[model samples]
Target chain A: MRVFENWDTSLKIPSMFLLMMSMALIRDQYLISLLPCVAAILFIASGLPLSLLLSRFRAPIVFLLFVSVFLVLFSEGDALVRIGPVVLKSQGAILALNTCVRVLSVITVGIVMIYTTPLSGLSGKLKRMLIPHILVDIGIMTGRYIMVIGEDYNKMKTARKLRGYMPGKSMARRFGVIVPTAATLLIKGFQQSERVFNAMRMRGYGSSAAGEARSYALERPSISSFLMFLATVTVSVLLIVLEVTVETA
Target chain B: MHIPDGMLPGEICAAGYAGTAALTWLCIKKARSSTEDPARIVSRASVMAAAFFVVSWVHIPLPPVSVHPVLAGLMGILLGWISFPAILVGLFFQAAMFGHGGFTTLGVNALSMGGAALLAWAVYRLLNRKSGERAILISGFVAGFAGVSLAVIFTGSVLILTIPAHIDAGTEISAILAMAAAHLPLALAEGVFTALVARFLLRVKPDMLL
Candidate 1:
């Protein structure tokens, strides 16, 4: 949870925004697609531990291995082993390479965003983007409650195990508690919100007061890095376009 | 699974993008009509988004690959048709934050998952189980499994429909078929997870279901 604690408390919102922007760019501009991945790598190299980045990458690599191993062994690349009537096309290797590169790119882009931004800052930005205030508030509450419910969940499991609630219990029976538990969790959560709201009201903190706090300023990206990012996106797009044109012709 | 960007074909991604936009618009319109207060509508939308946010990060690696909660069916039973926006937000965040799924395929993933949620709601209603608990679980399983399977079919179809007429139709068909076959287990896993979570919600917060 420590690895992810920073993720939730610090990295959630900004990374999400970056990811969305990168996704949009990847969809349309070929060059922009490359920037997030490259920039992410640079970010990791500068400050983040290389080991952590490598581990983040290891998940997709493992998944990719399963699919590609099948292709490499049975694939007909130059008829490497002519097993009776089968012919392995060299094209299979080419396809696998593209798939691997594509997956890595996607993973790296995600890593970059996570490493660079914090969640509060991201949500603050979204607030300015005109997403409904209520939704953001709910999101904040949800974040707070995940930890709360998660703690309750652990306690329940521990107590059950101590009392001999092991694997022998029916799957149906084991899950039976989830309903009431969720109900209690949410009702409590909602009740807490109501209480907090009322307390704020008593202290003169309601709709208008909350609105004033919402107008705080955000940190802008450094001008040099921003321009460099722009240039990288431009070059990457041009390269992709060149590749596509060459492939088509 | 969230399909990362660049892994999918451009035309297929475009179709997903367009389809998802239309669905979101429809969901917003429905949200407006269903609720009396703007705050209530926003709160309902956030519930789905919040559920999705937690679901994406709880990945349990089953060896070669990692899997997490799909929660489509659970969201459907708990939130009904409103699961659409919830799931769309979740998918959007997952792609953005975790890079689990790509941006281009957002529309397709949302439609596929949202369609499944709606389908579960319909099935649950058809069963007419007044108990609510049993109905929620059943709906969750059906919605989760069907959503994943249908999405695979949709993805394969997208690849086929746009693979250009001359690129050996047979090869494209075979490839998509293989991909679909490989995806069957993942769908079943999603169904089981959805059911478990639905049951959990039923136990912990029965009020959320309504």
Candidate 2:
């Protein structure tokens, strides 16, 4: 876990993306089945808490379960089992299993990437990767402010509660309160942004020469980082090759 | 709704990415040409995105259940061409921080949600030519309702059409219709909320409505 944490974001981001894309490309049921095991091994190796992963996994897992149930019940195929006027088809079961495994594996990789990499570092890496400069800047600012605005929201909610405000059973009444609160927040945010922009302008932001000077200064990867990146690419390529071969055969 | 990874085939995902890239490029170009100060636009959009993210946590209670508003319509009316990039940023954070959405399906999710936002913005602008608070409220309601409805339809169609299942065409169409029908109530609720907020903003901070 420490090793992954210490890895450069430039290398780590692309490697994880490649790993996820490869996992997505694998379609064979057997190959797809192996992915969850691989993901488990990766999870154990990362040393992240099981509870944390499970909590992150909860929503997607519930969704997958719903999808799997629908597939098993509604999909057309030979019956594998009969239960109280319901038929479980073998093909549906296989499809469900494949879908569940594939989604879990991809999600696990994403989880690992997010947990291991710092968001600040990730944004910097994205800027270096030739993404639109304004977009990346906006992303960074948005990331910084989500927590701040969220805290403001909490305070406002608490204040409302203190003032004897409670969302009643009536939906119309609830909207009347909630919409005003949301609008107030938006106004606050807009005012704050105007101040922020003024401050940034005072600091010489949006200077064309300065912007050009800062864009896309690519850094060469360390030997270890390069080797890891190479290994990841090789694995991803191999996975695609194998899948293509199987499909063609 | 955000589609999780591995739900659709890789080809569809790839195509989604391609389409998103093109749209993002076009939006950025539009934003750059339209605004005088790039930094100000970025800052404003970022703040608005954060506010939208926080506001989405506000629960709307419907008997036996509740839902968070997507706010894509409000976003479009407020941010204009920048709404797509703002949404993309918000979705990215949602996936990274909470694992609420999918890494692989980010492009598709953005297209469904952000594309709906753009449509809503166009509708609002078109209907808002008449000057008055009533006009603003009516436009806001229509945009909000249209935004959620289009997003639901787009997401449902994509899921039903691309899902690797053996269901017949009739069943597939039925599933898509059912999904859209189930979301109608939520769309109506969003419309009312948007209209109310638009009216409030018009009274307090009239400039913010744009």
> For candidate 2, lDDT tens digit of each residue in B1-210?
788877777777788888888898888888878877887778888999999999999987666788899888989988888899899989988887777778888889899999999999999999999878889989999999988999999988998888778899998888889888989988988887888888888899989876
Error in Å for residue A196 of model 2: 1.6
* Candidate 1 positional error at A51, Å: 2.3
| Weakest 10 consecutive residues of candidate 2 chain B by summed lDDT | B5-14
**Interface DockQ of each model:** 0.26, 0.77
- Per-candidate count of clashing residue pairs (backbone under 3 Å): 24, 0
Write one digit per residue (lDDT tens) for candidate 1, span B49-93: 553554444453333565665666556666665677667776665
Local accuracy of candidate 1 as per-residue lDDT tens digits, A90-147: 5455555655665566555555545555565555555665554544554554555456
What candidate 2 gets wrong by more than 4 Å, as runs, is A83-85, A208-218
Q: Which 10 residues in a row give candidate 1 chain B its minimum summed lDDT?
A: B159-168
Which 10 successive residues of model 1 chain A have the least lDDT summed?
Answer: A1-10
- Candidate 1 scores a chain A TM-score of 0.61
Clashes of 2: 0
Task: Supply candidate 1's per-residue lDDT for A174.
Answer: 33
